[model samples]
Target chain A: NAGVIQTPRHKVTGKGQEATLWCEPISGHSAVFWYRQTIVQGLEFLTYFRNQAPIDDSGMPKERFSAQMPNQSHSTLKIQSTQPQDSAVYLCASSLAGQNTEVFFGKGTRLTVV
Target chain B: SQLAEENPWALSVHEGESVTVNCSYKTSITALQWYRQKSGEGPAQLILIRSNEREKRNGRLRATLDTSSQSSSLSITATRCEDTAVYFCATDSGQGGRALIFGTGTTVSVSP
Candidate 1:
């Protein structure tokens, strides 16, 4: 299996611009997760979806950040009016099930907001 | 506050040496996982120790969990240059087990 696939391994966007990161989960996996990693914050859980439905997004910033999972195969994380603070590696992961299962992660999309 | 925290922000060792990383977490958890992330790649699970499991081993890696103390540890033996990576401890807590809460991570550098 190719595991999880994240598109545009690296992205460069000007300040105030928008950035959209994409993730294609492994076949037959029912859960997908999004996380942000920076040198300062390490790995921070952003949101997650199960069975193509958002389960929890409590970690997401209340403003300018949103995520959606239209189907079991794919999910997206979008940042509006990006700021330099948003510059970090956006990681996507998937698992066969939500609990007690091993989760696989993609290489991650490096988003650089200049 | 982070649910989990790793001790010793960074560690370095030469080939064939052994190293251990420790992690402590708050609250109760069903399971604890240890992941390793190489440069430019996402983290991958190295070991998972459930609340009922006190120790688990895989190849040259060993993991110990003390649920009583809400802490866990990972040890790598006979390390090689390829063993260089950032190690993180994650917990599956009250979030419906949908996502893992990660620690600050310990960067392990193994030089040849």
Candidate 2:
């Protein structure tokens, strides 16, 4: 298995521009998760989906950040009007559909907001 | 403060030596997991210890979980240069739809 696949291993966006990251989860996995990692914040949970439905997004910023799982195979995270502070590695993961399941993560897409 | 915190932010050891990484969490959890992330790679699971399990071993890697203290530890024995990585402990809240909460991570450097 290729595990989780995240496109655009690296992204560079001008400040105030929009950035969209794509993720394709592992086959047959029913849980997909998104997290942001930075040297300062470590790994921060952003959102997750189960059975192709959004389950929790409490970690998402109050505005300008959104995620969607339109289907079981794929998901997306979009950041609007990106700022330099938003620069970080975005990781996408998939699991076997349970709270106790071990998650498999992709190499991550490093978003650099200039 | 983070929900999970790892102690001794970083450590250095020679090959064949043993190293231990400690983690303390803030809330109750059903399962705790230890992950190792080598440079330029995503984190990989090393071991998963449930609340009922006090200790679990995988090859040369050992993990201990103390539910009462809300803490867990991971020990790597006979470490090699390839074992150099960042270790993190993650907590599963046991609540539906809740994801794993990760600690900041402990950097382990093994030199030959």
DockQ top scorer: 1
Query: Which residue pairs show backbone clashes in model 2?
Result: none
Please compute DockQ, using alpha carbons, for every candidate against the native two-chain complex: 0.83, 0.79
TM-score of 2: 0.98
**iRMSD (Å), candidate 1:** 1.0
What is the lDDT, from 0 to 100, of the residue A34 in candidate 2?
94
What TM-score against the true fold does each predicted structure earn?
0.97, 0.98
Top-lDDT candidate index: 1
| Stretches of model 1 off by over 4 angstroms after superposition | B95-97
lDDT for each residue of candidate 1 in B1-112, tens digit (9 for 90 to 100): 9999998999999999999999999978888999999999999999999889999999999999998898999999999999999999998756565589899999999998
Q: What share of the true interface contacts does candidate 2 keep?
A: 0.72
Real contacts recovered, all predictions? 0.82, 0.72
Candidate 2 deviant stretches above 4 angstroms: B93-97
Q: Taking the tens digit of each residue's C-alpha lDDT, what string does model 2 give over A83-105?
A: 99999999999999666789999
